[model samples]
Target: MAESRSCDEVLKAAFPSIVQKDEVQKEFSHFLVSKDLLPAITRYLHTQPGLHGRLTLLWAVDNRPTRNTYGLHYLFTLEPSHRWMLLSAELAGNDRLFPSITPHIHAAQWYEREIRDMFGLIPQGHPDLRRLVRHEHWPKGTHPLKKDFLWDHVLGRQQGEHHFRRIEGEGVFEVPVGPIHAGIIEPGHFRFSVAGEPIMQLELHHFWTHRGVEKLFEQQTLTAAVPLAERVSGDTTIGHSLAYCQAVESLLHLEVPRRGRYLRSLFLELERLHNHLGDVGAICNDTAYALPHAHCSRMKEQIMQLNDRLTGSRFLRGVTRVGGVAIDLTAAQLAEIVAEMDRIEQDFSELESIIAHNASLIDRLETTGVLTERTAWDHAVVGVVGRASGLDQDLRRDRPFAAYDELPVKVVNYRYGDVRARMRVRMDEIHESMRLVREVRLKIPQGPVAGEPSRVAQTGEWALSAVEGWRGEILYMVTAGENGTIQRCKVRDPSFVNWPAIQWAVIGNIIPDFPLINKSFNLSYAGNDL
Candidate 1:
């Protein structure tokens, strides 16, 4: 949007008062602010022209950090022109409270709440510092995401759901929805305070699928842990794999070959097209447009068939490995994928025409569950959700990696940020991904699939990687071995950052529109549960 932040020496000048500023490794830099200096440091970074850089990516990281007194870390991203910035910060483990950045950056709310849930780090003056991803009965002193925490035992210990605070005012009634919902979805509870038919306020309780993925990664070796990353979401398999692979490459000091990069981009675009088709189609189904849903699902079926033929896995698992690709696409396989894409293109064109011209479908989506630009930015939502709001921040174009360097992406921007805006973005992305798929066929490079991964990472090595996923940027952090194994690894899904935006979007709309708005965001409850 703006050219990368100017090189500013003033970041060094402003940050030291908070804590000792230090480089994370030679690869990344961070300013470690003491608890007392955080508010001042946050003010400086947001206002500082020279140092704050383009807030490239923002999510909190939790580890049973043996090195920190509080055993926790908070990260901020600063990049000049989407190229790079250091990504390390500290939250004192002892203070238990840090000033909230929600008032300052607006994008930091869910990130702060999630960190608090995972590591028990309290943020002072958080406008809405409610529990986000943890159960209500989840013990106070025993956060399951910590280094030596229990999962099954904690659930066993908790009785029925924690009783919520009651309101005494007349004509205020509470409606309780399920933690175990009706749909083929995970468990999350929603309590609404409704005066009559209109909802006054809603309180959501999440954390039914708590697998402790982040804490588990810290304990597992990187090579042994790639499977876990792939399962972050069955649909976002390729994106998470790429981020993890890139982080491993940084830890071991290896770069992927040009051909490997090209192939990775090829699979990524294929994955993107397939998911967007299914999602847009599902949205229509929710609005009771069955024909559009059927057409969309059928087209998606063809896409998945193409994926099965080309990659040997419908989801393309094991296609990415450390330092490069795990599998190479043969010439014939690529050709078949290209032909399938052409057929799907025709199918999509007809489908879009039918849905756009249908007045009933149009009325249902035109203005429901609108999220304003201020709410979108303050929450820092991304993917189709952010694109619909007119924040055209796609990492593939802004910070090019893989074959994306060759094929520039024109990000779709819509300012309305409604059901219509999101649907438009998804529809357009399918068109863009189609073009990329063909371009990939025309320029498939030749090379070995992978380099031999090192047995262990040396000490004092860290790498950060961010991939533009179907939903938005997914980030990964890897710290090299302390004793022949990975010291730390952290994964941040865009769903964690964007889930809270749904709350803002549904505020004024009738409860019936909540399903469509939620579908537009399509946040993964399981992905953020970690």
Candidate 2:
């Protein structure tokens, strides 16, 4: 129980010598710091008394052709003031070595490595400098994200190897699973070092299908990129697309119509319902509990079919446009949605009763795959994963995008951070989402479903947009280029940050429980790899 301080108060006391730029936008406040002061500022923001900031994202934008420098942007969330502070630093085109903050900020590890692999800007003192997005076959010097690199540039493969961390001990053996999984799951390699039934260490190698997604956005118009955002993760169509559209809208100073905002909240919850239902069922299936799994699957299918009837797409794609929602819900359609939700909720409650009565399933989940709150905080975990681990911050409730401000989302949190905690969080959230959906349908105002853009985006105008997708917070940072083209569109899927938490979750758990643990914290590979 600690009191909070204002951002200005903390900055004046902690960084009196440091100067911040005056440019502040609706999304966040911008500041330019030197490379040498990067680590100091990050550490202060992360560990300070009231300013315990979480490194939301760390990404680099190639500023070539416009300037002979690369821009490294660090986005931190200060919960006390509910403000996002963006620290930007420039690395000269010729000088690529920038000081790494990963040494002090654990959450910044993968982000810095990604910048190195994509932009060729090395974090001078990072412990693990190995390829993050780029694999060994990718030629050493071919950094695809540099502004000079063409989107279609093809490179020849070269012989190389990736070294995974090895644990050497008596009776400690390695279990390597999947760059190719047996199921229809996406490609990701998991290396587990187990000491006779208990996991000691787990190393993950993902991004097998890095599509150079960010690079593809460079020359595309803002409107044209909506479909691309929808496909960032097939499951999170509304989440990704809404975030991207909002970023564009922010830059253009456009406001979505009231009805459009309400419909958005409805669609987002529908997306959450289907995904969470599938995940709950998948978790049960992994534990040999087939009845609830089957029931959950049926419920999920019902919601998806409902989505198609309402939005014309099963995954709810093409429904979110730049200014607002593309589709509208009529009075009859709204009533239909309510009736459908009632049936599903009743069925889900019955299933939940069965699940709660089952002793064996509870035993299997209780202490399995525990990701401590401290670890969750260190990694900047989000959404269901973070909520399960007692990091009680939800963008829907905290930041309030779409219709969330009016709807008043109830954030679900659990401190155990176990498989059961994660499962319970999802279960509670399912009920909350259902309530929100019903409320949105009830009080939706009569207005346009979409809004027109106020004006064209000026070059260099940028904004950050976040939507609390089913999995977690989906962040889209879009910077306008010449003639309203996208200079850079950075997409940070929840999976990108949550994937690393799985390594900690698996420790002390046996190999047999890995599937259950993973399913409980279901993450998107396409979203992360993108």
Candidate 3:
């Protein structure tokens, strides 16, 4: 790999008209570009070589009190440099309009729509400028995320309808699947345009479970927000909590204890282990294969029990605090965890063998619900979905955090871009996570599991953190207000980025295969709805 370049050097070389007043920190470099230059700059960063061209996050902040203007922050990661560049643009006066980059950067489609829905900031020139997060019942001209909007305020209901796109042709019909699912999953509606058995297009509408998580964070003190972060997505409790904690710790320039870092890594891997095991089974179950699903479920239950024994929660909630983890592992507990890893490895290996040899199962998975590499890149999918499509990027290795700097990671990737490729990536990752847990348990240093919490000084500062969750990269962007109160907290779950890719993934597949393809991606509606 080539030596990394500074953010300023890269920006100057790409766009010479860039101005001053930008902020550059160790974690990321912030730039302030004009509305007109936004699209050009975004396109350059995305298509340029070695820049990685991935939009980690894009969010709007109500900065009227401090700057008397609304601000938009666009965060991008350059993989080769392992650096993040944040482009900031302020919308002055009543116009609150900014040129949309969605035309050039396809991944900005939903982010732009979300800004329009939440902050009422218009993304001018956007192809589809429809309401995203706010559904039909939400009152018009009322933006929930604005600083002036009362958190507890409610408005009278209105009669409205969602206008889903239609396909006009002979023998063409639309199938609407649910904001209410058959299973116990969260609410999300999938509109499929199909002819007979084959699907022509798929459009997804979620946000039914949007709980105003970001708005709730604004009312929470610095320390009181960890629990909220843990609940961003129930299954990704550890990942979201760790990301939020790291961002807070970064702002304060606090370092966690070495032992705490190792413990955090162990908990993260344990979370990954359970989720991957359950997903493997779920995917098999979708294919009508019961034996592998049963075995995988058995192994997954054992890990969940171990989690409850180690931490207070089965999902590893309340384990991560701002400074460090809340609990430490005893020598006996470490030994037991390591022993459990051995048993899990043996059992999972047998399950993998059975899956590999089953001809019927193999036939169902191979080339089913294929998401081409082009589609993955256009949508900027991450985590297992990105890796399975040959986008070789993992935040743990690309940008190390917790104990990952000391304990290196080997990324698992495949180019098939099919259901089988995604399943293989998950299987390989389970083994990798188990190995990491064993290594951390054996080589972990004996020391305090947490450090003293730092006093956050009142300042206008922002911090960013990214963790490679089982699904993909979970990003947290935190900004501090007076007395260290959270002014704005933006979370970009992997589901948000990967959900759009599903529209393309299910294009050519049949209606019955939609469930299997959806399981292969295994996105979270609650996470995205936030």
TM-score of each: 0.90, 0.98, 0.98
Q: After superposing candidate 1, which stretches have Cα over 4 Å from the reference? A: 1-7, 13-29, 47-68, 71-80, 83-95, 127-130, 148-156, 159-172
Candidates ranked, most accurate by lDDT first: 2, 3, 1
* Candidate 2 backbone collisions, by pair: none
So what's the TM-score on candidate 1? 0.90
Candidate 2, residue 71: Cα displacement in angstroms equals 0.9
Encode model 1's per-residue lDDT on 1-530: one tens digit a residue.
23332332455554535333344443334545555665566656655655543344544444335555453344444533444544345555455676776677777766677778776777788887667667666656666555556434435445435556465588988878888876777777777676766666666666677687776676777667788889887789999989988888877767788889888898899889988998899899889878888988888888888778777889989888887887888888888888888989998998899888989887989888788887776676777898898776898997687779898898889999889889999999999999998998898778886787655677646678889988899888777667645665677888877876776787667777667777877888777766
Kindly give the stretch of ten consecutive residues in candidate 2 with the minimal lDDT sum.
1-10
Clashes of each: 4, 0, 1
C-alpha RMSD (angstroms) for model 2: 1.7
- On a 0 to 100 scale, what is the lDDT of residue 160 in model 1? 37
In model 1, how large is the Cα lDDT of residue 188?
72
lDDT agreement with native, every candidate: 0.74, 0.90, 0.89
